[model samples]
Target chain A: MSNRGPADTPPSEYEDEGRERLSYVVGLVLALLLTTGAFAVVWLDLLSGGAALAALGLLALVQAVVHLRYFLHIDLARSHRDDLLLILFTVLILLIMVSGTIWILYDQHIRMMA
Target chain B: MTLRGIVGLLAAAVPGTASAGSFLEPAGPIASAQFSHFGVISALMLIVIVPMFVALPIVLYRYRRGGKGTYRPDWEFNWGLEVVIWGIPVALALALGMALWKHTLEYDPYRALGPEPLVVEVVALDWKFLFLYPEQGVATINLLALPEDRPVTLRLTSGTVMQSFIIPRLAGQIYAMAGMQTQLNLLASETGDFIGRNTQYNGLGFATQSFTTRVMSPDAFAGWAEATKAQPAALDAAGFAKLLSPSVVSEPVLYGRFTPGLFGQVMARFAPAMVQGHGQAGMAAPPAPHQGHHHMPEAGR
Candidate 1:
């Protein structure tokens, strides 16, 4: 019903869809890279031991953040901000619970052993 | 609603040790108390965990596309409810934590929890428990004998990687770490054959890592030890090496007339620093002509 020809239509919608698809592929590649990198760090720690284990654990945390941000598309969108915040809070709680258990148990063991 | 249905669901969800197994019976009072503590803690946790799981689906379904309520975008926070929910669990956890701490101290392995305790030096080899009795001067592999009502102290260390020493009726699992020793105190009120095993997965032989425990009268234990000890002259270093060789299925062997300080020597081998003041300082070294100067026992022959 438009008076203008089909050539006059703006190409912004096609460009937007293409960008969404490209972001998705980038997200997939990032997820694979982070996962494999995390595994490599853990494997190296197993072979080397000691400080490598600490380093591996730290890398794992970073890789988990990378996965959540890029692969999961957890970003600055207002609608999804609450979901991202909840996830961050959950991760914090889990870290606190796990680290607390290990610290308390290790302390108790040291005292008993001494 | 139905207990059987709930049990079925639980069994489906958590397999392995959570379900019934032959290895869970207590060999002593300490183990029994520890098991009870675990049970209480698990029960308490289920009260919160089960409700959370049950509410998950309800919340998800209610929030789905075509639900009844007028969906309000402005609903932000529920601070009071959050505080109440989290506060109760925190209080409960603190109370449980204190109870466990007190009990753990009371049941400390180094302290004598009972009278006339039997001491068993447990060496976790490739896949077995080597029990050495210093007082009796006898050593046995994969077999343990103890007199009922006596407190049993286990001095545990691993030959290789870390392993967890566990005998359900005797006490909770304690670590058998390389270059380190862990002690567990156990007192058996009843006389029976209980099983002890490694709870940690170390390597290929881990699945078969187990030992037989017999709680008999003092006279019976002495008789059993004497019978096993009097078998033959398998007491030299070569004989000891043969015994120590890794095996998947080794029949129980006992040495009645063991060298007086074999236990100390074994301890020194794994943990050299701990046996400093225990008459091991001035004692002559190994019979082998190795790194240090010591009296050498004739090899095997």
Candidate 2:
């Protein structure tokens, strides 16, 4: 009943698989770079507390996108629309829960600090 | 009366029999703001909930066999109706989420609402609350005293397992984790006592872990502090050590002196090596933890 083609298709499918492997390798290297950048900032103590936090958060977000795009194969391609929408919805729910918990908890920390 | 009417009446009567846990009956600006948020959420929810409840009977009766409702067997879908159905909830949720975000910032406990708030260092033990008024050089077990209309800041952490500190009438709850610090800022709009408790479960003595909050005038608070300072049970290292015995404190006990950095020492107990020479010197600075930077392994994925 689904529109998905069979897993064992022709030479075209094999070409797609080869390209997928290349993207994975590229994503892994990029992820490493981002992670190292975040560590370098922290280990070197180049930035203050809030700046370091912001830098790390931004790097982490970019790293997440790298993983989703290359590793998970989520993209703006028409064929990926349904799966991307599902993943985006999942991300939306996670953003709500995680951000809400942090806001509610950390706000208290700010108010109560001596 | 219908079942709904009966339920409403029963809910109305609940206030008479209870000790009070109504966020609706807030006592301060924080609680009042929270209550407004609650109002918006409930009203929005009712826009969804009330329709579902009402439409159930209407749909069942109308669409039942041989009913007068217009039949549209050939229709697979209605684009306009579908758009409205999906769009309304999405729009509502987006708007509500933004409001929550705004309020979260506006009511940030760390934002310093007014003048320097009275700092009350709260240590959540297994079965009781140990409060230290560092400025007043006084401590109390299971009793909190705050001056009315003045912002009071609570810097809280757990000596035992993770717990949450909440005074339902005054402000929202925040977790008190072992080896980590959390905070809550609150104030009493009136002179009265409210119930505060550890909403987190931590082994056997969890049920008994609650405290009495007495909000008094400035003069009354000063009087209470002076009278508490004269109490015999001084909060030296030994007194604080005795508090960790894993038993419920039946009544509030006052201490003349609380050891400096006592709250930090309690947190450091869970991470002994993390707090090196400070604990031994009997004067550890309060827990202001810097989060560690760690990387996720690619292989794990």
Docking class of 2: incorrect
Which runs in model 2 stand beyond 4 Å of their true positions? Answer: A1-114, B1-18, B271-301
lDDT of candidate 1 over B134-252, digit per residue (tens)? 77778888888888787788877666677888766666678877655667877777787777788898778888887777789878888887787776755655665665666665577
Highest DockQ scorer: 2
In terms of TM-score, the best-performing candidate is 2
Report how far off residue A81 is in candidate 2 (Å): 11
Tell me the tens digit of each residue's lDDT in model 2 across B1-301: 2433444456577765246544556678888778777766766777678878999999999988898889988988889989988998998898889988999999976555578899898888878898999889999989999999888988787877788888887898998877666668887897888888989888888888889988899999999999988887777778778777798888988888877878767766664543443222211111224322211111011
Q: State the lDDT of candidate 1 residue by residue for A40-78, as single tens digits.
A: 776655434435555556666676666666666566664
- What is the TM-score of candidate 1? 0.59
lDDT of 1 at B209: 82
The clash tally of candidate 2 reads 3
**Ten-residue segment with the worst summed lDDT in candidate 2 chain B?**
B292-301
| Cα lDDT of model 2 by residue, A1-114, tens digit | 112447768768777767877888899999999999999998999886556777887888999999988898777764467787888899999889877776655443332221
- Candidate closest to the true structure, highest lDDT: 2
